[model samples]
Target: MSDLFDLIIPPNPPREVMADGAMLLRGAALPYETDILTAIQTIATRSPFRHMVTPGGYVMSVAMTNCGAAGWVTDRTGYRYDALDPESGQPWPVMPASFLDLAVSAATEAGYPDFMPDACLINRYEPGARLSLHQDKNERDFANPIVSVSLGLPATFQFGGLKRNDPVRKFALRHGDVAVWGGPSRLRYHGVPKLKDGEHGTVGRMRLNLTFRGAL
Candidate 1:
């Protein structure tokens, strides 16, 4: 696929296999792109995005916030999901209907039906920003799959095996692409390489990721 053509106007993306238990639904989130961005804006107004500090004392390059019953957070205290925003001292913003609908639709398309994610972690990445490989182990259950929606600039998504040293596969994820992993691939390690400089018409010079998980 031509990256240039995909950047401008993508053909309706079809469901493709990324791994044994992972599926990539290309352009699945296009219909909800507008609503999702609007919802992100609304969520940010309430909880806001901040570059969180990891337990190791390193500041993350990706700015993050959340909307749902709980929000994923990290600091010197270690990583965990909290019901309230540490900054606001109030419950994280409620997950919007549009967000819930899109997530469920994408998840269903990827063969995971009835994916009711209680937490939506929003990540913003600019040039030079990256996410090291990690697993979503904070969740209580691995039965539920992870449904992630990508928007704005393109990114290099890395997926590896359960062990950190396991061989990694790279996937080019563009706006509107949704990746869902569960079952055999639930404990896979994944991350994003540093984003290259690019300007997206709607999201500007950065990329936004909406990662939904059952973090109860």
Candidate 2:
């Protein structure tokens, strides 16, 4: 059978507002799915995905890797961006042009016209994987929007206010969807709930998220 992507992702994807500065562009990345997936595979072959450890000594549930001028990493020392992959002692793989184009286009659509991402953090989530509520504050500049592209199984996304106790709005992030948040919502707390079991035609039994940011 075909991937059935055409049935899931409409030609005119709607942009749903999540907050003052956040939005969900449904099926925004559908057209470039094949090319984006190819780039991810190539990047993984070089840097590979691994569960990172937090400074508190807890192992993260999500497996991650990256590409571009810098890569986000966490260890006993602390959470921060590193120009070189700790595992390889070399700079992370260069960001693919396909990826850059997708990020820039998505950001522009989200109202951030001058967004130029320096880091592409690729996260892989398996069944039962969960990401706790956290702010994306490691980036040096908050003016650039965070462009997150979803691939594979659908999962519940959490978007909340600046404080941890703020009420969170939950929504499903389906395959090929792109989420963007910046400006007033740049430092907002957000995360994904535990992933459920499922198989996607393009990405199989797991979810792949490409989060582009200005890490440098």
Candidate 3:
């Protein structure tokens, strides 16, 4: 297990990757922290945190919510998107302007201009929480890029290739970092390792991750 992360991969983000797809734009959200936080607060009011159960009945350590045209969900039936929040039995919270703007901007920079993501998955990870490596293939369209924004306590992100055993790259994402990927890299597997216990001035002992995608 240690060998899986032994490779101290550097963040050698290439310009072409930024122009085509799959690029890490460090600190892209730093300037918009206030706006993003406000958006999060608004969404939380509508769709509060809930620990979703996986198909295996294991409770996910992360609490999640969503806002947009569609929202991602995982249950005994498997991972899928629904227009309404299953918990509230109503439509998911509306996507805030700030969230939409960031997704669009990040996608455009990654060579998918005019991108307007209709699904946003918000995950809140606390100490010891980790996301298993998996592909974001449940979305309806693979052409649309995935834009992820990181905030609060730092976490190690595992970015792999199309194949499960493909060499993986790691990066410590801090608040305000944005990762955008699509095109041939849209199906790459990725996840986060267990988060160490630590508190952030704004987010406490947790990490916030926003994933924007096109669902319809």
Candidate 1, residues 136-211, lDDT tens digits: the string is 9999989999999999999999999999999999999999999999989999999999999999999999999999
Q: How close is candidate 3 to the true structure, as a TM-score?
A: 0.89
Instruction: State the lDDT of candidate 3 residue by residue for 114-135, as single tens digits.
Output: 6889999999999999999999
Model 1 misplacement above 4 A: 1-12
* Worst window of 10 by summed lDDT in candidate 2: 1-10
Segments in model 2 whose C-alpha atoms lie over 4 Å from true places: 1-11
Candidate 3: misplaced stretches above 4 Å?
A: 1-20
Query: lDDT for each of the candidates?
Result: 0.93, 0.94, 0.87
Candidates by lDDT, descending order = 2, 1, 3
Error (Å) of candidate 3 at residue 216 is 1.4
- Tens digits of per-residue lDDT, candidate 2, 1-216, equal 245876776457688999998989999898889999998899988999999999999999999999999999999999999999999998999999988888999899989999999999999999999999999999999888899999999999999999998999997999999999999999999999999998998799999999999988
TM-score of 2: 0.94
Residue pairs that clash (backbone atoms under 3 angstroms), model 3: none
- In candidate 1, where is summed lDDT lowest over 10 consecutive residues? 10-19
Give RMSD (Å) of candidate 1 vs. truth. Answer: 4.6
How well does candidate 1 match the true structure in TM-score terms?
A: 0.94
